[model samples]
Each structure stands twice: as C-alpha cells, then as structure tokens.
Target: MLGHPWAATELGPLPTWDPAVRAATDLVLASPVPMALTLGDELLLLYNDAYAELIGDKHPAALGRPAAEVFGEVWSMPGVGDVIEHAYRTGEPFLEKEATLPIHRRADVAEQSVFTRGSCAVRDSAGRVVGVLTVAAEITQVTRQLQSLGDFAAALAGTLTLDDVARVALRYALTVFDADRVSFAVDEGGGGWRMVRRVRGELMDEADERLPPLWRRGPADWPAPAVEAARRGGASYVDDGEPLRGIAVDRHDQKVRALAAVPLRAAAVRGGITVGHHDPHSWSAADRALLAASAELIGQAAERARRFETQHGTAQLLQRSMLPEHLPDLPRLRIAARYDPGVDGNAAGGDFYDAFQLPTGELGIVLGDVAGHDVQAAARMGQVRAALRALALNDPRPDQVLAGLDRLVTSLGAEGATHELFVTVVFGVIDADRSQVTLASAGHPAPLVRRCAPDGQARATYVDVPAGAPLGLGSRPVTRTVPFHPGDTLLLFSDGVVERRQQGLDRGLATLAEAVAGAHSGDPRALCAAATAAVPGATEDDVAVLAVEHALRPSRSASMEVPAEPTAPSRVRHWLTGQLTEWQVPETVVGAAVLCTSELTTNALLHAGTAARVEIDLSPERLLVSVADSGTRGTVTRARTDTLSSRGRGLGLIEDLTDAWGTDPTVRGSTVWFEILLPAG
Candidate 1:
C-alpha cells in the first residue's frame, strides 16, 4: 500500500507468482505503509486502499507501471533512474534527495521516504538488493518553500547592497507560500524601511506605504527604531498588523492585516525583514521554516559576497606588488612571466607570485599561497610573504627559506583565527654566473623547467623541479633541488592555475604540465600568459605565477678549498650526496658515484685525518676528496692490522671510485687528496 495513487483494479491482473511469492505479497499488502510489488525487474507498483487517498483523482490506471511511464518526460533527464537503481541494488530506501518529480510546477524533487538523510535501499529476504521502498510525503510544500529560499540566497550572493537580501527574502516568502503579498522594510536609524520592497494590490504600491515616528503600544510596533532594532536582533513574529496607537497614514495601517518579521543580518551585523499581508491567514510549519531558512541563507550569502570582494581586492593588490615590472636581463635568455587572478572577485583568495633582486644580487623568485579567502586570509598572506622575503636574506637555501616562512606563520595568532593555517613556498636563486640555477622549496607547487640545447640547434627540452610543501604547518618536509644548464627556462606557478574543486593538487599540476609540453616559445612572459590563460577561470581560489629563464654569461665564479670528509666509500657517498643535493646538482650524475664515493672516502678517513685535518673539494673539472691527519706521515700501503681487511687496508679503493689518488704533507699535517675528473657525456 504505497502512497502511489494507483490501485490494483487500475493495474489489471498481475502475472501469476510462485506460491511463496503470493504469501509474501499478501503480507506486504497487510502492512500500514503504502506498499508496491514488482513484476520481475519492471517494478510493477501495487497500492493499497490507504495509498489511493493521497492521489485523490488519479489512481487505478496509474498502477502496475514503471516509474518512467508514471512520471513521463522528467524521467528522461539525468539522475532519476540512477538514484532508483542505486536504491534497488543496495536494498536501501532513497529518501529526501532533491529530484524532479513530474507532479509539480517545478523541477526539484524532494523525496520523503523514511531514510535517514539520504537514500535507504530496500533488500530481499536473502539479503540481496531487489527493490526500493519509496514513500513521498508530498513535501511539495517544503520543496516550493526551500526553492524560493534558494532563489533568495542566489540574489543575496550577487549583491553587496544591504537591502537586496531583505527585499528578495520577503518576495520569496510571498510567492513560495502562495500568500497574497509579503512586504518588508528596514529602519535606517529613525527612517523606516530605509530600503524597501513589497507587493501590493493592482492600484496600490506596497513599497510606498510609510509611517512617521509614530509609537504604538500594540503587538506590531512602538517606534521605527525599537521595532527595527528588535527585528535586527533576530527576532520575528506573526501578527494581525493594525494601528492601535499613534500612527501616520492611518488608512493603509487599518487596511493591513497580518505580518511576519525576522532579522536581516546574515554575516555579523543587525538587519531586519518584515512581511505584510492584507488578509488574515495561518501559516503552516513548512512556511515558517522556509521563512526562517530564507532569511538565514540571504544573510550568509551577503557575507560570502562581501568576503569575495575583499579577497579579490587583496589578490589584485598583492599581484601588483609582488610581480616584477618586467623580466630581468638574464644572459642568452628571454624571460617573461604572466599572472592572472583568473576571476575578478576571487582574486583575494590566496595565490601570489614574486620576483625580486636581493641585496646580494641573486634573483629571488617565489610562488605561493596562504590557502583561504577573505580580508584576514589575505592579510595573513601578506605577512607570510613579507616574512619569507626577509628570511630568505638570512639563509636563502630553498628549504631553509620555507622553514623560516613556516615559523613566521606559526608565530601569528589571533584569538579566533582558523588553525592549521600554513603557507607553501618554492624559492630559487639564479647563480650570478648564470651557469646553473640553485633551487629549493618546502611543500609547494613545483617549477617547470626547460633547457635549450647549448648548441642552439635543437628544441628546448623541459625539466621538472619538484620541491617540498608550502610554508607552515609541518614538522618536517622533504627538500628538493635541480641543476639548471645555461638557457634553461624555469616556469613557476601557484595552485589556482588548472585547479578544480575537491580534485586535489595533482590534477592541476598534471594539467599545467600538459599545457607546457608542446610550446616552442622562448619569451617566458608571453608563454606564461598564454599558458595561464588556457587554465579554467572558474576557480574559486586565486593564482600566482612567475617564470625565469637562465642564460649563461661571462662572470667570475670561485669556491674556496675549505671542506673535510671521512674516507669510507659509504660515508663519502652519503656526505657527497647530501652536500651536492643541498647545492643543487644533477640527479643522474649524483647516483653514479653514490656507491663509489662511500667506499673511497671511508678508506681515506680510517688511514688519514686522525692525525690532522681532512679536506674535500668539488669543482667542475675534478672532484677532489681528501683526508689530512696530524700524523707526520701519510701512506698508500695496505694496513697491517690484525685483519687485513679494506677497512684499514690501503687507499687502493680510491683508484676504483676515482681515476687517481695522492698525498701531500702540509704545514700542520700530511694531507692526502684524491682527484677524479668528472666524466663528460
């Protein structure tokens, strides 16, 4: 006896079922709720007499039909059948999902079956999903009500003007609830309904209805200020609005009958709403809920709109302040970068880019975000960005720079600021000679790099440099670096570009990579603009971008011989790997010597450095790994220890990891330095 209007007689004879099926069908028919039976998978509907009452005029013929035949064209749209299938497949009831039911003047369907918040699937006796038990309590009332409220919410979201929400919400209540008219006013200090909207009879203008500073002791009003203040305090009422005391425009006041009022404030200020009707009528619970929900939605939407504006302003200002006026004069390279907030108002929501010259003359570039929207979020972003710039001067290492930025954010505390606030940053320093670019980052978006053939005859090949996370909110983050050849282009960006809601960071990054894969341009700025433009602008978050192309130039570059290390191959390998990665070397070459470096360095340390100091130096031509000890003599002979193992055997392994090995007697100790000309391929 499902709530379906159709009856068994209208459905005609159902197909003959097995004896067990007939008994089960009988039991279902005896139940209190409206019930239905399916002829196989066709979902043949069966309605008991109690179910027939809800349909009023339409029944009998409506029985034994697929839902598609019952609802007609609405079934052709998306999601309806899928929802029903999901319910049947899982044996749970589908409840209160907003769908389009064919019986209404609207498209939204609000099912009222007894599932929790979503669909409750119905199951067979054997625990397999067989059918769906659906009960629609015909909340057309609630549906229309909430729809009007949603409309009001939409209007509020588009506006910054204060009165628009009240006007829209009032109008919604009138139309959705089928009331004659609902009008509202606000009190701008002593002025009543300072901004107003209302519906009236054919000859009357409800918006024009006004009263002076009249005070009445009745249920509806005292004065413009008191009534409006009460309303703004989130107070509301239902009343037979009539003048029982002091008033102006006494005639209309007498004509007005009932009223309802609620607070107009949605985001943190006092606003008021009032609805008027000429006839006395009782409102249903659904109507009242719609009234309240609409007002709330309107208020919240207004706040969201205002916040979007603020963040948008902040994003624009930050971009203007952060991006360089033009690309720097990087030798042999044409560098350009483009940045767009994507959407005008959402620009305030956290992405930023910067390229600036540090006092040391190193080119410092950063791309980052603070991860939220609003004026406060933007302010925090500004603080972190400025702090990052200052901190970069102290260490300038990509990891260290981001660490400092993280510490900066942790130190910022407001009594009510959202926690888990962190920043992600990628920072890089272009070498003075422009031979190589030293890059590092905390958790952040990675930079896109493309190296042009030094011969200038082939197309530029792209390289990827992925750094650690953005600034803030992590105890420890992975450190990363990549070497750059002359004429290499490194394109940096923020998360706003190519990002989608709830899809995570990887998708955006993948899309970005694809955008750059086939480009042939050397102008970083033009390329950047075109690349950024290809990303979807529907993003709610802001985006920041900066691109740098490293080009070689003639410049003096030198590294002093001031280093030491253990001589074991394993130890040497570990130390060299750490130092080289920190200094940003090629990943492939570092891997080749990884094992060899450890064995050679350990051998030198065991037989040297104990009596003096150790020295290790890395240059473009040769990697000099040495160990000096205070001992008067250094030897290349195999050790005579109890066990003649390679631990103290000799410097024989040095010849293995490197091309040659030697020793030197310095002023303080005998120094042994090995040299290996790095291979060229």
Candidate 2:
C-alpha cells in the first residue's frame, strides 16, 4: 500500500481511510490465517501478507484495487460475490466449505481451486454494516486426489487381457502419481514370478540388458528393498542411504534413489507393484494408496484372462483334430480346401472337408456340416467323416455312397444316438480323364460350376440337382451328372457360405456366383480365396469350402481298327505314325509312339486271337496309347529276359520306353496302355 502509485490513485491515502476499513486492516494484519477486507460500495480490496501469498502474482497490485477488478475470474462463481454482499447487507456471517471456483493465479492459465470461505460484516460505531471481512483456505490438492481414484477405477473396468491390465495400471500410476518408472510382477504358482517393467512409459523386456540385474532375479530372491516390501504386504521406500549393492540403477548408472513397493491382492492371485524415482524423495500416504489400488485391479484382470485362454486352447485342439491332415493329389485336377470355426473362440463347430481316392481310381470329395457348434457336434462330425471314408472306398458313385451313409446314420440312431444329430453333405466323384462329375446332395446346397464358354469368357452357374432329406432321416439321395471340361471349376461348400441371418439362400448363392465370375485366375486356391473374401458379413456359422479346377492343355486322341492277321502290327504302326504327323506331333515323339504302339498291337492281336483297336491320346506333356482286343487277361507282368532271348522282351522293352503303363479289363476285352512324356518344345 505504501510503495504502489496505483494505491494512491485508485483509492484515498492510508491516512484518509474509513474507520471501519482501518479497523478491519488492523485485525487482518494481526491474524495468522489468510484474511482480506473490501470496504464501502466500491468494494476496495485490502489484504494482509498471508492472503497476499494465496493470490499469487497479483498480490501487490491487487492491494488497493476493487474486489471485482482483482478477483474478476472468481467474482461470478456460485456463492462468491453473493455471500460477500449478503454479509455486508444484513450484518450477518456466511460460510462455505470446499466450494469450487475458477481462480486466475498465474498469467498462462486459470486453475480450478477448492476453498473454505467465511465472510462476516464489519460494523462501525453505531452497529451498521460498512464492509465485508473474508477468510479463505485452498484445498485443491485434496480434491484432485479423490478425482484421480475414480478415474483409475473406471479405466480398469474394461480391460480383457492380462497385458491390457498391466499397461493401464502402469500408465495411470505414472501419470496420476507422477512417477518415473512402474513395474508389476505376478506369481506364476511354482516359486516363480512373471514381471513387466516400464520406464518412463516404455515397457522393458526381462532380457533387455540395459535394465538392472535385480529386474531379472527370481521370485524367491528379495535382495532388492522394493521386493522385500512387497513380500511383507506393506508400503516401503528405499533411498540412496539404504543398501544399494543389489538394487537396480537408473539411466545415469546411479542406484535408484527413491522407490516405493506395494502388494496386489485379488480373489485368485497374488502380485506386487513397484514405483521408482530418479532423485531422492519421500513417500506420501496418497501415493501408496493409489499404487495399491491399481495393483488390485491388475490382479483381477489376470485371473479372468487365464480362464479365457484355457477354454480357447481346448476348443482349438478339438477342431483341428477333426479336420483332414492333408488333401489328396489328383491327376488333371487342382483342389483347394479350407475350414473356419465359429467366431466365438470357445465353441468348436461341425464343418469339415475331405478329399481322398476311391476304389475306382476316381477323386472323391466331401463337404459336410453337422447341425450344432459344440464339443459334441465336433465329435459327431468326426464319426460321420470316418463312416463316409469307409463307405466311399467300396462305392465310387455319389448316390450309392450317400445311400450307404444314410443307412449308417439310421443304425446309429437306433443304437441310442440323439435325434438332434443330423448331417448335410455334398458328395461328388471327379473323373478328370472323362471331364465329368457325379454329384449327390443330402439336404445340402448345390455345387457351383464355373465354365469357360466357347467364346473364351468364364461364367458361373449352380448345378441343378435334387436335394433329399438330411442323413439322419433315412431318405434316398438323387444323383446328377454334370459336364466338367478343361478350364472349368467345381465348388462345394457348407451352408455357412450361402446362408446368412435375415438373408435368403438364393441371395447368398447369387452373390457367390457373381464373385466367382469376376475372378481372373482359374487356380483352385485363388478362386476359393476370392469367393470367401467377397462374403458380405461375419459368418454366423462354421465354414468349409472345397474347390476343384480342371486345367487346360493341348490334347488330341484318335482310334482305329486293325485286322486279326500278321499285317495288323505293321498296319497299326503306319496308321499311328500318320495320325501323329497329322496332329503336328514332333518327329522325335512320333518314332517312340509308333514303336510302343506296334509292340502293344502285336501282343494284343496274337495273344487274344481277335481283331485289335488302337486308341492314342496326345497331350502337351505326355502320350497315352492303348491297344484293346477280345480277352479277359488278368496280369500283364513283365517277363525277365537276357540279350539272347527275344520271346519275353516285348513287355520289358515297352516298360523301359514308357513313363507308366497299365491294363484294364472291359466287359468283352482287355486294354493295355502306356504313357510316354513328350519332349518339351
């Protein structure tokens, strides 16, 4: 008041002050608590040294200013100005405890302050109110501590994994308590503890060499002061004055000067937490309480995550055991298969696929689904797959295989199987050489056929096949034969591909067909991947898909008849050579083709004593030649021979020159065939 020139201009000099204000000033200066006085209608401000420190940088200039000008930010708060006016008007006292207000203390930002304010009217000689005397104490730190606790509780509620819980607890501890490093350790149940440590918000691995050796110590060892405190289940602090030989060091290679440790407790597990500082410091009760609360939350989350992982692992094992270990390799066809369980990781579903060779030398493909998604469903699927494989080995026809499966399912039901156990399967046999597919559906979706038309454009269309009752109902399945030429593909899938919630089967089928038509690659793997990627939403059920594509190759075949005489071999060789020349087969392959054809033709006519028919097939990679005659010969074994023996050398010579050779018995004749790989152009 004596030094500021504004004090003289803004209000009258100290000698000319009001009697009430002079008396209030004398009382404020004598008090040890914060005190301020505003006198008259202008509400001029006057405060002692204790109150001056509370007002921060505005102290000296605010001494003689009006209350509205000095405390403008806080004047409009809920009860601030009103309480002062009420006290001055009625000569009564007003009090508020822990009242919140936005006070401008520093120049850069306005801080939220909680205060206890008591205001009373200052009276003159006639007992009339002249000014207001207010005393205030700030409690902002206490209010912020309570708020931090609430926020930490809410943040820990939504974490689902152990790692997520650890990260959240460490982050809040560093931010709320203003600590430099946070570490969490959980008991691993065998005298071991798994620890996660973070320094300045970055997680550090146990293998990180930059960390102190104390971090890598075992659970039974408590040489470090922090670990001993956690083991004893109370808060403890370590400083540079304590033992520092085994403790961890900071980035500066100095022992951690200050550290606090707390124990974590939950229903199922026990753990610990440690917080450290770079410089020497003291531990406050508030800091210990916050760390202990965070540790408890982390313990609870770890227990829940452990249970989830156990269930997920069991479900995965069951599903994988029921699926095929490997797919079959077919001769002119490519196959791709995939199976995906339900999105919920704990429940195993019943979708499966199988590709294997049948007794008739044809490819048997099966895609099926049982009507549930549980452990029992998975077990039933395995049984169904085993039965299908056993039945397919005897019968290669699709309808016959399904009929056998229906009988097996009926027998199982009679033997006390559940009525809810039902299966829908699409069984098909692919004859790559004949370019034909025989498919049968047992209450399953029809397979899709993607064909390259004569104009060289690809299009997809679903096979029109009749569906019968599913397996457990004992209905006979109907079979259909579809033409599958080179550059064509066949797709068989479970209902998950074409059956979605709130959508019709026809709509999903159309979507799948469109995706297949737009695919540029005819490779089975590529086509299957593209089709699955085009599905619109999350799959509600398990998915299983099997795709097969017949590759295109430059091929030609010719057949002719030869007389049952000595001239038959010579005439057949000449005819085969001429045909190969006409087909533009290379000269190098024509000679070998004629030689193999002559040897087989001569043997067929002489041994069977009948006229022979010659069939030759030329592909880009190999040549297949077959000679058929009227005989039912069973074995076509090669006879051993020496250089001097000419009678048993025909079969041996043929075997040596051909890549592969076999014989098949027809209704009235036996046909011998050999394959020789053509030379690369």
Candidate 3:
C-alpha cells in the first residue's frame, strides 16, 4: 500500500503518515494476528498478511482502498459500520462478540463468516480521534458446528419411534457436517442389521438391490479401526482407501472419499451410524465427538420405543385371549360383544367379557373390570372369568354367580395372590322363555334396556337395580329381574364407555342412553358399535360391552293333553291340525306341523312311557309345535339316514321338513319343539 499506484490516484500522496496513522500501522504490522488499520476521513484500508489471508481472494486489490469500498459486502451489516464509526468519532474502543458478516470474498460466491470484532480509536498527539483500528478473529466453523448440534438435540427430544430417530439423525448429520450422504443401521441382533440410507436428502429405496448390503456381516468382520472403535463404544473415521473396501460403497455413480462411523449403545441394543463425503477431508475431534453424542441419543430413543412396542403387543394378546371367541346362540336373542383397551399407555387394562351356556338352558353374560392396568390385573381377570363360567354351570342365578366370584376374588387377595385388587362386574342370565333378564351388580354400573314404544320410537332406560359394593369390598349383591319383553335389548358395558376424564359417571351414562335411543338399527351389534362410537374422546380405561336383544314372541294356541298309549300319536296329530286350522296357519305348514307333532309324541311315549301334551304357536312369519312328556330320558336326536334302510326315518323326516328343532329339559322330563316358516300369502 505504501508504493501502490491506486493510492496516488485515489487519495493523492501519503501524509508523511501522521503520528496516529504511523503508530497504528506499526502496531498492526508488528502483530501476528489478523489486524487492519483504516486511517483518515476516507478510512483508507491497511491490512496485515494474516488479515489479507482472512479476506481470501480480495487481498492485493483491497490494499490502499477505502474501508467501505473494500469491505462493501459487510459494511452495512447490523452495527458493523456504526461500531467502526463510533470508535473513530468518539475515540472509545468497542468490542462485539460473534458478529456475523456476509462477505463476497470469492467472486459470485457469498458466505457468512462469524467473527469477534474489536475496534480501537487511534488518537493524534492532541488527543483527537484519528482512525479506527479493527481486529477480526473468524470463528465460523466452531459457531456453525454448535448451532448444528443444538438443532439436532431439539429434534431428537421429540422422537418417539425408531424410524423417527433414524430420520432425524440422518437429516441433522447431513446438515451439520455438510455431507453428501448419511446412513443409519440398527443391529437386528443375531449378526444382522437393517439400514436406511439417504443421499443428498433423498432416501434410497430398501428394495433397490443396487444399494450395497448394510448387514451381511457383523462388526467383527469390518476393518480393524471401525471394529476397535465400536468395541470401545466410540467414533472412528476411515479415509478413501483400503478401509473403504471393508465398508459397503455401492453408490456406483458417486465414489465415497471419506467415511465416519459412530457406535450407538443403549441398554437393549447397539447399532452404528455412518456419514460419507465425496471429497477426501479430515474430520476434526469436535466433528467425531458430535457424531458420538448423536448416536447415543438415538440409541436411547430406540430402546424406549422397542420396550413400549413389546409390552403393548403382549398386553393386547393377553386381553384378546380372555374375551369370548363368539357369543352363544341363545334362543330368541341376538348377541353382540366388543372390547377396547385404554389409549394412554397402549397397555391392556382389566376389562373383559364372557358369554357361555348355563346348564339350565340360559345364556350367562358377564362384563367386568379390575382396578389396575398391568399383567397382574389381566391375570386376575382371567381367573375370575374362568371361575364364573364354572359356577354358572351349577347355579344359573345372576346373584349366586356374582356371590361366588366375589368370594373367589376375596380369597385371591387373602392368599397374597393379588395386591389390593378390586373388581366391578355385572352378571346377567337371559331367560328367553320367560322374556326376562336377571342381573346382579357388584359395584358395577346398572345395565341399560332399550326398546321401541308402540309409536315406533326407540327408548332407552337404565335398570333400577339395587347397587352393591365392588367385589373384594365384601358387600352382598342383590339380583334384580328386569322385564325383557320381546324386541327389548339388554346392554352391559364397562365404565370406560361412560366415564370421561372431564365428566362424571352419571353424565356419561346419560349420554350413552341418548346415543342408544338414537341408534339407526336395533340389532345388538349395531347398538354396541354405536355406544362405543358415542364416547366423547380417547378412552383412558379399557371398555367392554355385551348386548342381548330378544326378538318378537310367537302367538300361542291352547295346548292339548293325550293319554300315553299306542293311540297317542294319532290323537295328538288330530288336535294339532284342528288348532292350526283355527289359527289360519297355511295348509302347506299345517301338514308339516301335524306330522312333526305325531313323530315327537310317538318318540316321547316310546322312550319315557309317560303321558304327553302338545302345544302350537303361530306367528305371521312362522309356526312352533312343542310336545312335552313325563320322560327323563327323552332327548331329540336326529338319526343318520341309511339309503338302504327305511325304519329309522322318523326323526330324520321331522328334521328335513322343519326349519329348526331342539329339546329343553322340563322339571318332569323334556320338551321337543320344532319350528316351520309359514308360506307367504
């Protein structure tokens, strides 16, 4: 600058260099660090060799030029020019830490450089501010690295799944290190690993065979450096030569020049992450350290996700196995059942349902929930369900069944088999013959009965059954019989259906009743589904539902008694035909009914040797004929037809001609009944 031609043309001659300018120049030239002196009103630029190198390609031409013209790209940056002007004007030094300057040092290429800028005002002998002497120490690499790690940490904290961890790790690694490609691999235990790779922000398809294998071998098969680093749970960098061969580099189009692998260690599993670059570059200690830290975070997240999934799966399986595989085919009833686990932990709660046949020909339906949500509660639920099924075989009463279950639960608690476990259950027995349902509640919500009024509008109301303390609380439960008329439905559900976090149980129950009344169909399955749908939000507890609907009853014609003798079949058949004719039963169905009545009466007299009574029922859709006898061994069983034989076709003939036939034991003997559909008019 002292002998440059531009200095003579732009600012005339040098001022024999003033005292302040000369002193600043001497000080800047003597310093080994990057320094620059801007002198006079024009702020002419003078920079040391180190400062010239910091400016990149703008060295020689920038000498002897004005500060604004030389550093024009960053002169207007926030507080840049103002700080320099303040020091020059007020003679008060200023220091700014980590100031950003956007510089175009390379032609057509702009870059942001972070620096610590310190400016001191040079004074004349008279103490007047002369020029600003500024020093800049560039820290762009260190600042950018820290910012990248901060971003990675922020994104890593919100990840909940293994895939989420992989995606976030790859995205941040590429951005932070400015790498061309990044790939993450998780060890699949037994010497196998699954890998996901992304190149320049594009994820490669797993099915693409062109992509090299990620887990064909274990870590021991890799190069010594990578294997040793993994053994020590650290990070290692492999250059673009022999070490690259041990790693998969099947990106045929782009040759990998460098690679760095970091071991991800967690309590459950261990994995590896690798970042690649196309240019052969050395990785600094800070870069390797950042990669290691990111790998550790990912490993921790993967372990948590794995543990949750495993627990959720096991809980779901256990809960499902405890529920009924299918509802029983109860006479004159349609049944539907459902179960849903809580949403908070995705773990199964103690809610369960069961439908089984009692010895008395009644269908027993049970819905219950244990107090807690865990393996122990689920196990206890299974034990209670099994006990209830066994008890129902001997005792068909709802109150008796619940009483036994309560005792069983108390026994379990007393034996240290359970810990403070309380249970709520509603046991019900449906008697289709009597058109009634008896239910017993053990601290459970009352069952709901839905029916259509004469006006064809649906109405839903809860049974006013007396309450009892939950099982394990030692309260005797009372059984209440509700008039389950034809076309009425009985709905039993867990509290999860009507219990919301923000609402009381009463309000939820009211909402459920309203939903049931507004249902589009009266079918049991449809009603149960609608009730579950009516829940306000995500359920905090498991839900179990059981619905039973009694269909319309058939009209009855008076029953006839016949003497138990050789002539009883003919007598019963004559009486049945006459009754059917008076009831306007179709001719085609009447003939079949008479024949079935004769066959059933003859069989009963021959098998039990007792008197028999015949009854007929007619509906707009069908006809029912029942024959009761004072025989203990009388059971309706269809005989297999032998094409060559003719004598064993009585029961076979009846089965072929009728729609359905079954036998139910009476107090004295058994009643064999057969139904035939009436012909359409």
lDDT of 3 by residue, 1-681 (tens): 567763464345666556766777788988898999877777878889889878878888888788888777578776887788778888888888978887677876778889988999887777777778899988898798788777777777776455567777877787778888777766656654556666773533322222122223344344433344445677778666434554555762146678888888787866777787887878888777777777777777778767765786577557666766656754577676767667643466798888877778878888998877887778888898889899888887888888888888889998976558889899998888888888889999998999989988999999987769998778688988878888888899999899888778888898999999987545565677678767687777877788887877434547888788898888887777887888788788888888878888887777666898887656555676778887544234445543222224666677688866655433356677777766666
Candidate 1 residue-wise lDDT at 35: 51
Lowest-sum lDDT 10-residue window in model 2 = 206-215
> Whose TM-score is higher: candidate 1's or candidate 3's?
3
TM-score of each candidate? 0.36, 0.61, 0.58
Query: lDDT scores for all predictions?
Result: 0.52, 0.73, 0.74
- Model 3, stretches more than 4 Å misplaced? 1-39, 42-183, 195-260, 275-286, 304-321, 324-338, 417-419, 431-436, 448-460, 481-491, 514-533, 537-539, 546-681
- Give the poorly placed runs of model 2, Cα more than 4 Å off: 1-6, 9-64, 70-74, 87-263, 270-283, 329-333, 404-418, 450-458, 485-489, 497-506, 523-529, 551-681
- Give the Å error, residue 539, model 3: 4.7
Indicate the TM-score of model 3. Answer: 0.58
Q: How would you order the candidates by lDDT, starting with the best?
A: 3, 2, 1
Model 1 lDDT per residue over 1-681, tens place: 344433343333334334444555665567665455443465565555545544434466656677666556645655556666667665656555454444422234534322112434444455554445554444455665556666666666665433344445545665665555444443343433333344543222222111111111223444432255445475545555552224323444446566566665554433444555667756556656666676567657546544654555455555445434444554444444444444443344555666666677777777777766655566676777777778777777766776677677666743346576767767787664545666666666667775555564324333344554455465354444466666556787776776777676666666666665544433354346545655654776665567665544422122222224433444455666777677554575466445444543443344333423334444443454555455322223332333333443334444444444444323233445555555543
Model 2 agreement with the true structure over 270-302: per-residue lDDT tens digits: 567777777787776766676666677666676
